[model samples]
Target: MTTESIDTAAEIEAIHAVVAAVQKAQRAEDADAFLALFHPDAIWTTGGGKFLNGRDEISEFTRAVLPGATKDGYATYEPFFVRFIRPDVAAVKVRQQYFNHADELQSQGSPLYGMTKEDGRWLLTFCQNTPVVDH
Candidate 1:
């Protein structure tokens, strides 16, 4: 494998880990764990059309929103594409599908996350969830 391929693979893996953290936190309804995946100055936009910036706002948003998902029944997520804009910056587009405790489908949407590497570890910088529109 070439140097470029190795770097890409590593970046992708890092992105995957970040997404996994988000999913795990959501499923478990743990705000602290979910916030751990983001930078101190991270910004978030929700499917309900709201913008939250900084760690405190991020925490508030997570605590308030995640429980709703849990109450409504949410499960895991799958990142459809992780695009490396540069060696230290990447974008991941994912579908966070929710299922009831009984494993019945609930809701799903594409959540786009932008992240950057600081001190060799990826931290989410921005996130937005695009609601699924039915025609």
Candidate 2:
């Protein structure tokens, strides 16, 4: 998409909103809210390296794991980089962090979300969460 055809600033803002929503859902351990952010055929790879295809698969995995995930603390996502391949497609790089109840960082994740605009709403179409380990 050309610059004249789309507003880059608005798109970026919308993308950030999605990321913020994900963070909120995670903090609340709201699996349904989190799943609603993905496309029907979305793909996801967890930080532990489990590959899930489609919303059904994601839902299954999420339901199994999301509960009590935030009993101690929660994961947070920040969309620091966004590359628009087109007006409707973007690659977002997020900084994911897991903190303990005392706010100490326990683990970090580098998650890349492949987002697509479907019906004017941006949805996570493909994503991979890789744990960050200190060398």
Candidate 3:
């Protein structure tokens, strides 16, 4: 493989790891772990349409909701696509599914996460969680 291909592979792997951390944090209800994956100036918009600006706001929102968000059901985030805009920036499309304790499907979400590589670490810089609605 060429150097470019190798670099791309490594970058994709790093981004995937970041996405996996999100799933792990959410599933385990580890607010601190979840928040640590984001940049200090990150922005997040919930599936319900609430806009959270910056890490402070994200931290507050996540800490308040995440712990109980999965009490009845657990959430899983799977990245289906990753587009690199620059060597240090990437846009990742994720499919999020919620399952009840019995493993029944609860809801689905399509979230787009913008991540940036800083100090060799990939951190989420922006995210928009959109609910999948069926008419």
Candidate 4:
């Protein structure tokens, strides 16, 4: 493999690490810690297409979502598409599959997240979670 390929792989891995850390913070219901995974001016959107811009809005959204998620039971974030747009930008597409204690996929949600490396750290700049709705 070429050096560029290796670096791309490593960068994608780093983005995964950021997602993992955010998941950890979410499971713990730690808003402060969760916010640490995002940029201060991060833009977030929900399945309903509601945008929460800036730190305050994002913080509130995290506070509301995390607790409910923890209560309903947290699902593992399985990353599907981990691709690099450029050396400094990357995106991760993850599936949040709701599971029971035995790990069954009760329901599922897909979240597309865009991240950027700034000052030697990878942080989420944008994210949108779209849950699969059943009628």
| Best candidate, TM-score | 2
Better of 3 and 4 by lDDT: 3
Candidate 4, residue 6: Cα displacement in angstroms equals 7.3
Q: Candidate 3 versus the native: TM-score?
A: 0.93
| Candidate number with greatest lDDT | 2
Candidate 1 Cα errors over 4 Å, as ranges: 1-6
54 Cα displacement, candidate 3 (Å)? 0.7
Candidate 3, residues 52-128: lDDT per residue as tens digits? 99999999999888867677988888899988877788889999998999999988999999999999999999899
The window of 10 residues in a row where model 4 has the poorest summed lDDT is: 1-10
Score every model by TM-score.
0.89, 0.96, 0.93, 0.85
Better of 2 and 3 by TM-score: 2
Deviation in Å, model 2, residue 55 alpha carbon:
0.1
Residue lDDT tens for model 4, 1-135:
133644777787788888788778877888899888888888989877889998789888778777766675666787779777766777789977777766667888889888888998998898888897889
Candidate with more favorable, higher TM-score: 1 or 2: 2
* Residue lDDT tens for model 1, 1-135: 123544787778888988888888888888888888889998988888889988899898778767766775667778889877777778889987768888897777888899989999999898888877767
Off by over 4 Å in 2: 1-4
Q: Taking the tens digit of each residue's C-alpha lDDT, what string does model 2 give over 1-135? A: 554588989999999999999999888889999999999999999988999999999999999999988888878899999999888999999999999989999989999999999999999999999989999
Write out the backbone clash pairs for model 4: none
Task: Kindly report which residue stretches of model 4 are placed more than 4 angstroms away from their true locations once superposed.
Answer: 1-6
| Whole-structure CA lDDT of model 2 | 0.94
